[model samples]
Target: MNPKSCLNCGHKISDEFCAHCGQKTDTARITLQSLIKSDILGSIWHIEARFFRTLKHVLFGPGRMAMNYISGKRTRYYNLFSLLLILFGFNVLTLHFYLNLNPDEISEGNSNILEFFSKYSKTILFVIIPMLGTNAYFIFKRIKLNIAEHFIIGTVSLLGILIIFLFNDMVSLVGLWKPAAKIFGILDKASFVLFILFPAVTYWNAFKKSYSKPGLLWRVSVLYVLMGIESLAIITVLYRVF
Candidate 1:
């Protein structure tokens, strides 16, 4: 029976919900249909719907994504690591399959396909996260971020920089004219700064629990230098190994 008085506002109501307060007069018991509709299907729908919102938060809000995730507002955005992995996987596959043809064999196609695969497959891209994040953890050690957290920051930073790299890859694969390629080649190389600067900007926004402007700049700059050194070291090592 519908309660004569609403449980929430004590307003007289003959229906399931209180007219004024909108609280239900009866305690709604869970059913399989409701569970499937509201919990299971709704979760997938929400995540799918919020994909661009998550990207916008990462792109426009800087520290907002990390703050929301760390503060247990997971449903407000997508999983940070999950998004990172998807982008990384796509990047890896695109590089390997689509854009990694031998420049020397542009005329003959991949006649030496095995040789190309060997060199490309041995790429040390995995060192990216550890290199950036390790220095971040140490630089921000006063705030006591864990390795995983630094990894998240590094991942987000790389995601930002990867946009440029992906664009560069697309331009390279599209077979631009010689002069155009020369111009973009310079841009492609110059974009390496964004690799470091993106994280510095992100951490500046996020790691502000106890830092003034100058202090934060100093710390993030230190992280940038350290990460840059690590990137150079990794590239040197890869050159030697491959």
Candidate 2:
């Protein structure tokens, strides 16, 4: 039998994959069934599988997951920034649709901290992630992670926090019904507390194996102090601009 030329790179081959470019041997004409099965569903399944796997680690052991990525055990995980962007996009949709949130609706008189946060949560998160990365770099200097690696840890921690935030938003959607309105209000109030607590918990889980309880507490305290300073700086800038 003659060797079949690879449709992708025109290399002659008998194997299942192209040696030159690694395209599959069966590069037949595109059909509806093939497109749906191989292109659409295949891509979705791949992304979904990796996304869930990454979410599991991000939720339960973000620090360790970051460490694993830093140490190069990364194939099992989805791209962190991509996942962050997806969550951020979803948050935007939920804010608009589920919460019926509008920045203009927040009157100047009611532009308190929480209102400010709701108005600018996405911007705040974008600025704060890098600041938190910087804090981690300095605070956990003994861990020997570089600025980028520290940033990865910070991103992973924030991803977990965002997941919690997303869940809260989802449950708050249930609160929209008349019977659950009270519960919704309570959840809305509790979100601020969770926002503060989740990051601290994520960092602790990430670094618990690395630091003693007392040692970790003081470090986390310093981290939060840095975060507060950063938050104040952001708020000041926003207030001046707006």
Candidate 3:
């Protein structure tokens, strides 16, 4: 047949998709049915599919996934920051609605800090990204990834950690039933231990191939120590300021 102009970029093409911009050669009019079925639902399904696939890779092989992403094989994975933000939002909602613990009930010294974090959890989460990124950049300098690429791995590790916390929040909902309340209570206490080990475990899994087992362990250890110190400094400054 004859060539037609691509509506998206004015590229001339005769195939089903424009060679220059990839817009479809056959465009449909925007009717209500097409908008709902093709635009809204299609977009939603696309995003959902990518999100779950990305989560599976992140959970099972975060290191390989991050390496793939850094090496430019990124189309298969969801955007790291986007996934982190989505999971963070869900975790926050779970904490607020399902596991709403009172700050006053926490230990005296930590109550204020807990309250502070509860109020500004999103901001705090974003702030922690850079801190984690910096620590990883330094600890894994031998890996040959730059600071920005290190940040990408940091984002993936943080996403895995958040998934752990999200699981804790979800399982905490089991406490609502009187029959499972005691068991969930035990699980709730165990969550503290999970929080401590989860990050190190995530880092270990993500960097296992990059270093020797012993070397990876020490680097992961130092990374957490640095993170703890940085967190303590931030909390101290916050306490003095507000």
Instruction: Tell me, by lDDT, which candidate is best.
Output: 2
In candidate 3, what are the lDDT values of residues 137-231, reduced to their tens digit?
88888887788887887777778878878888887776777799899888877876876776676677777877899999899889888989998
TM agreement with the true structure for every prediction: 0.63, 0.81, 0.82
Q: Order the candidates by TM-score, highest first — what do you get? A: 3, 2, 1
> Candidate 3: lDDT over CA atoms?
0.80
What digit string (tens of lDDT, one per residue) describes model 2 on residues 122-219?
A: 78887767888899888888888888887888788778778877877776677767798898878877876877876687678778888999999999
In candidate 2, which residue pairs get closer than 3 Å at backbone N, Cα or C atoms, i.e. clash?
none
Order of candidates by lDDT, top first?
2, 3, 1
RMSD per candidate (Å) reads 8.0, 3.4, 3.1
Instruction: Output the worst ten-in-a-row residue range by lDDT, candidate 2.
Output: 98-107
Checking candidate 3 for backbone clashes, the offending pairs are none
- Write one digit per residue (lDDT tens) for candidate 1, span 147-240: 9877777666666655545555565654345668777767666666654467777787787767888889888778777767876786667556
Of 1 and 3, the candidate ahead on TM-score is: 3
Query: Residue pairs in steric clash, candidate 1?
Result: none
